[model samples]
Target: MDPKVITYYFADDGRIPNHPSLPLILYPGALKEKSDRIESIFNENNWRNSWTNGVFDYHHYHSNAHEVLGVQSGSATLQAGGEQGTALSVQAGDVIVLPAGTGHKRLNASPDFKVVGAYPNGMNYNLRRGEIGERPQALEEIGKVPLPETDPVYGTEGPLIELWKHKERD
Candidate 1:
């Protein structure tokens, strides 16, 4: 089945410095029948340095790399875009693509919750809590982080690429 794409935009909000051009992308139930192959799927699409774990409980953002997370085992309530962001519930097979600098935190989760996360081309990622000191530099890094060559869950022609590109052109 084709996955439905959902998009959201989060403003900078002083501290988090959410991506200015790209909106967060969610593909619900994209991998429902193939949750076990999530890692391989991301790797095949050039999203590498994969890890399997639950999200951090505190809000944080990555300044240097975009991130993709595939729900592998259970369910979670994740807050995206810092304190003013949206809270989303996700279960196995859900995939979230967060552009660089988008804030995220795990509000709650099932005991068996597990997700596989990866970055484009195995790019190194930096963790930055919503601290006052991480301002301009984080903003700069976020602007410099390039778009991923391909979507983590889908291949080259996924909704992610189109949505992000369309936003950039606006």
Candidate 2:
């Protein structure tokens, strides 16, 4: 009596059951769960400004996303895969389980980091949408990459992104 020994429990997005590009879709009710004009929930998304100099620019990977970051104020460092500089100093609630290829970065940015993210996917966008053969050699190495220090919180006159360059001739 062994019908191929059936035993199924497919849910290891990150660990136990919470990884599919950070998925755990649920919304019930509890401590002030008021719905109306605001509910973008990716831990109340608003932490834009990520980088990687040398024209490398956001190298990606994710076989089944599961990004969970919860830091209620300042502190970030998440560089995965390459491990050239080594980063992973997450703070606050600190509930990590970032599986998949694990290549993320949001390092050293704190005017109060403030985070709360929960992802649990099984529908789509565990993104790896390819079509980039390093467009023109990564825009000729991001036009000879530069800018490592000058970060007075954007006052450093940094991000003016527009690689893929080659503009000469009057």
Candidate 3:
């Protein structure tokens, strides 16, 4: 058996390049956690500033971009394939890493759930909107993998609540 290989490269101040997703999920403010350097293998490299809030929301992964969500406070579940796909539970100080081409969403189990993540190779979060537009089959509703759950968290029928707006602050 071989051990996983790990390499370390330091960027002064530590930050990664930004890979913006098309059609933009959440809002600018919600995604405004910001970065400083690019980790040879991570997203939003430095974790000094953070993107957080008290709300229930969902997101999908980019075509070739995976994500790492580490819970620093409260807890939540990463639900894939609608309501019965894969349910990964997480609590304070726990880490959940989703590989590239994986699609999933989060359920805010607490009034205030916060997480810090590190993504290597910056973010291509997903292929361009044009790319998805090219593939109607892939773009046809995420969560069809049918995550296995009867009434998992964030699994209900109702109006999606509003959280943040797409406004920028200077």
Estimate TM-scores for all models. 0.96, 0.23, 0.42
**lDDT string, candidate 2, 22-100, tens digits:** 2211111211232221123322332112211211135343443333333444446655443342355654433233433
TM-score comparison, 2 vs 3, better candidate? 3
Cα lDDT for residue 116, candidate 1: 98
Model 3, 53-80: lDDT tens per residue? Answer: 4223554443343344555567677553
- Residue 127's lDDT within candidate 3 is 38
Which run of 10 residues does model 2 get worst, by summed lDDT?
1-10
lDDT of 2: 0.31
Task: Output the number of the lDDT-best candidate.
Answer: 1
lDDT of 2 at 40: 33
Superposition error at 57 for model 1 (Å): 0.5
Cα displacement (angstroms), candidate 3, residue 9, comes to: 30
TM-score of model 2 (CA atoms)? 0.23
Q: Number of the top candidate by TM-score?
A: 1
Q: Where does candidate 3 stray beyond 4 Å?
A: 1-56, 81-83, 127-170
lDDT of each: 0.91, 0.31, 0.33
Estimate, for each residue in 1-170, the C-alpha lDDT of model 1 and write its tens digit: 35599999998787677888899999999999999999999999999999999999999999999999999999999999988999999999999999999999999999999999999999999999978888878888887888888989878988887787666611
RMSD of each: 1.4, 19.3, 18.0
